[model samples]
Target: MKSGINAIIWEDSANKDYGMQNTGLKSPERTRPHHIAVLAYQGLCLFEFATVMEVLGNRPDASATAWYHLDVCSLEGAQVRATGGALVEATGGREALLSADSIIVPGWRLGPVPQEITSALLEAHAGGTRIASVCTGAFVLAAAGLLDGRRATTHWKYAGTLADAAPAATIEPGVLYIDEGNVVTSAGSVAGIDMLLHLMRRDHGVEASNKVARMMVAPPQREGGQAQFIEHTRPLKAAPAIGAVLDAIRRDPAGEHSVSEMALKAHMSTRTFFRRFKAATGHTPLEWILLERLRLAKDMLEYTDLTIDRIAFEAGFGAGDTFRHHFRRIVGASPIAYRRSFQTV
Candidate 1:
């Protein structure tokens, strides 16, 4: 939603089951269901932990024969206290990690991670298990030395702390998540849903991922590069003229909006306008305009039956080829493919 896209409606696939053969997409050869181990500890963050469950665990639409084999492994014990004093019963222990194809660490409690947990994670990674962290769970992966020299992300509020804690890792606070081959790290809270959906896309395909996301009533694909929900640091006394320019651009993204024209409309020189615009909106004028146009184009793609050429022109991209290029580059999918994945009608 922060990316300005609406939730996608599920298109009923020909194959109601989990197999991808009917979708014309080949899934990775798997004789058995993939094993996913979710780590549970005391004072666990319930929402992040549940996101992994909801995404990868069994559901009405997911057949047990084809869905992932999810095990809640307790780091503390069989019984662990989650947030708000809720108790969770884990199905397995740390030994589950070694056999899992993927391991998910939900948000971690602040402070030192237990040596045993870190040791287990290290062994799991060493055995070719892909590891992922949601929110503060990144601290655990950092402690395990899994994030060293890799690009990772966490809640923007904790980005500085994580940077200090794992100096060897590159911390990107703006994006929703980062997938570094075998290591994946996501931002705080609900961003974990996005990251998990991305994993579903990688494991299954766009159709299968879209099916799962539809069940959750979420967007099928929000680009990982999409910024986190961080408020802009706009000053209260910021120039009203810059605001007017921004409003005008948003109102008519299809209109010709050159830098000189915007500067003139804002009653300032180009240099002064550029400074004021960035301070107020946290983006350059061009960047903001491009984002607005893309947002509009995405809405059209999902909610309307507009042709690609017409939508491209309406969104100010001028030509379908240019629109397709930018859409794939920024949204990580072609406009047509995005339409197929998200079109509500």
Candidate 2:
């Protein structure tokens, strides 16, 4: 095991664990689950809508004892066509906004959001409801002025336009998502899945989030700090060679694949290989290898009942001490603590 590094130990009891305000498991006046309202509009991006539904609507552990209500709402309570031309009827109108505990905007397809929807969003924010947007849906939140002066991110392809439009909002490009307290914004497509999973983790704890992720057949956490597009970094001319090396590294992150070895395999000199590799992957050879290993370690921590040393070895960290050092630096938690936080019965 790698030695000589002191790891910061965090007290689990002192850690902040947030819970939903309205689970509706027991109530004196009425039996009502905490409501999550999704904004449905014409020309909506269907995938993001489906993501919200899949993550929140169908919890595997949900039963008569554990459930949260979902509401599909829009300005007019009418059937709307998706971007692909499929029709969908909403559960209610703008009036539903008043009762929602959290509101989600999947994605805004057509330009010029209706004033009514924007107004409802603003009202909801002013009334202390949590608001989140996926992809171009950040535009809707920006229009409502909910993202003003807050750090946010959107699809990197549209980041420039959103930035130009919302000068007051800090546009952090390339990130998966950004959480600014009550408001959250995510990048394109799958990043939306990460955003909702993050909410589940924050409100219901890691165990609940992991359960939801397993049901979705997806990773429970992909720290919001991760880049939205790692493959785009490669130069077109050198893609095939560098791509092969990257694939190999991913296949065995713990393998001691040195820079010289990778360079020789790619048929490039060490200097050229370093430059080209950095260009294609947005990270240096060492950084990318560590990232992949850490990612594997995180998955093991969440899903497998393995000891820290075994997980470290499987993740290519060689020693439990080395794993602890890198895990603390990247994930901000020790391996044991991270597993403890996400541990399930």
Q: Give each model's whole-structure lDDT.
A: 0.79, 0.75
Who wins the TM-score comparison?
1
Please provide, for model 1 over 297-317, each residue's C-alpha lDDT reduced to its tens digit, 9 standing for 90 to 100. Answer: 988998999999999999999
Worst 10 residues of 2 by lDDT: 1-10
How many residue pairs in model 1 have overlapping backbones?
0
Q: Estimate each model's TM-score.
A: 0.62, 0.59
Candidate 2 residue spans exceeding 4 A from truth: 1-32, 223-345
**TM accuracy, model 1:** 0.62
CA RMSD of all predictions? 9.4, 10.9
Best by lDDT: 1
